[model samples]
Target: MTFQDYFPIWNKLQTDQQDRIRSNLNFRTVKKGTILHNGDMDCTGLLLVKAGQLRAYILSDEGREITIYRLFDRDLCLFSASCIMRSIQFEVTIQAEKDTDLWVIPAEVYQDIMETSAPVANYTNELMASRFSEVMWLMEQVMWKSLDKRVAAFLLEEASIEGSSVLKITHEAIANHLGTHREVITRMLRYFQSEGMVRLSRGMVRLLDEDRLRQLQD
Candidate 1:
């Protein structure tokens, strides 16, 4: 498939507009752990994932990391082209969470097209709004939800994403996602084990009671 196949408004674009985007599109493959965009310093173009996963996160002054949102197959990430969005003030880092295939549309080229195309501008604004909504939801989760509930929710979300009860993720990784510490996650996992909610082994956490975990998350 091509970018047109994944982009919803591709057919609405004029021939020249389509040609300009096609000419500037870049196909890329990245390995897991590769940092594609480094905060606000690198204005890496808009990324459209063809396969695998990408994680968008922000780091605090003290170096703590919290995930803002994740991009899966067919997902379009607009924040990578932060320079195009003048309203975006904070820095965000994007990394490959798995071996990934994607296409990047050059920011300058896309911005130029947006200036002449109302449809493209509208689509870009909608995408930006959706990303901000996800960030707002994460803030609410962190503010009002307890650690145990957050952990349970994360585990369940991971299970659904990976299509399994056993999650191959480390305590430190979970802490990084939730913006907490390794020791705190370890303590919470031990408590979950005591309650027979999960079974931990080395770098894995296997869900034992899905119903109980869902209840706790609620």
Candidate 2:
């Protein structure tokens, strides 16, 4: 769905309010594999993903990439609450997973909207709460769950959002998301494929036996 379509809060805006937003919003197109912003950079604005997928991650001192979250179409991205409260730089790097179209709302404009529009403020609160919930859930899973369980959870999340069983994703990306090594992801994927739970190719994975995959998690 388009940004304006999925973001139902926007529909509640008055014409003048919409005009104000349009005035500050900027649209841009990015090719696949583009890094939109890096961790520890100055917070500039909210990135609204209109189309395509984007991944955000943190790099550890040991240079390991830990996937924090993914921003798909209709998602609004902002600096983490910790970063914003402390006036620190961003905590994650954002990268486009495919050719992407985006609408950027400057920080000042976003703040103004939040102050002036109840709908916009409510939207922001809901988005932040969701992000916080996901973060907590991921932390719990990483600490208590098996790798297979983690993979199953990730696949289910992706499939739920994409509305499809086939996922066009890379092994390295999955590894980063799981905070593991690429070799480990490759091996796990092979095992899953051999078990007829999934089909893997160069850059795509298809869930062939989702029931079996879930059972593996169990």
Candidate 3:
């Protein structure tokens, strides 16, 4: 599929604008663990995911990492083009969670189009609002929810995303995502294991009781 297939306002753009975008678009295929965009210093352009998964995360001063959001097939990531949005001060890192195919529209070209096209500017604003809403929801979760509940919710969410009950992930990875220490996650997993909610193995955690986990999340 092409950028026209995923971009909602593509049909509204002028012929010349569309031609410029199509000509300048950069297609990339990255392996898992590849860092696509690092901090605010890099303007990596707007990424449109064609396949696989991408993760948007932030790192604390002491080196703790926490996921802000995730992107799947057909997802549009505007944060990668942070140079065009001067108001965004914090650094957000974009990485390939799995082997990914994507198309990137250059920030300068997109900004120029937005300057002339009201529809493009409006659409960009709407997208930014939606992303900010997701970030706000995450902040609420972090502030109001307990750690156990947060871990349970994260596991359920991960299972749904992967479409499996058995998760092939390490405690350290989970801690990194949740912005906590590895020992804390290990202890929580042990508690969950004792309660018969999960079974922990070498580098995996199997959900034995989804109902209980769901209850904890609620």
RMSD of 1: 0.7
Ranking by TM-score: 1, 3, 2
**Winner of 1 and 2 under TM-score:** 1
Q: Compute the lDDT of residue 180 as modeled in candidate 3.
A: 88
lDDT of 1 by residue, 67-178 (tens): 9999999999988999988888999999999999999999999899999999999998898899999999999999999999999999999999999999999999999999
Worst 10 residues of 3 by lDDT: 1-10
**Would you give me the overall lDDT of model 3?**
0.95
Report lDDT (CA) for all predictions: 0.94, 0.78, 0.95
Compose the digit string of candidate 3's lDDT tens values, residues 1-218. 67799888999999999999999999999999999999899999999999999999999999999989999998899999999999999999999999999999999999999999999999999999999998999899889999999999999999999999999999998998888899999999999999999999999999999999999999
Candidate 1: segments with Cα more than 4 A from true spot: none
lDDT per residue, candidate 2, 1-218, as tens digits? Answer: 54567556888887887778778777889998888777654555788888898887788788888877888878778752233434444377788877899887777766767778899888777877887787787788889998978887777767787799999888987888899888988888898999888899889999998888767677
Give the clashing pairs for model 2: none
RMSD of each: 0.7, 3.3, 0.8
Worst 10 residues of 2 by lDDT: 80-89
**TM-score of candidate 1 on Cα atoms, chains taken together:** 0.98
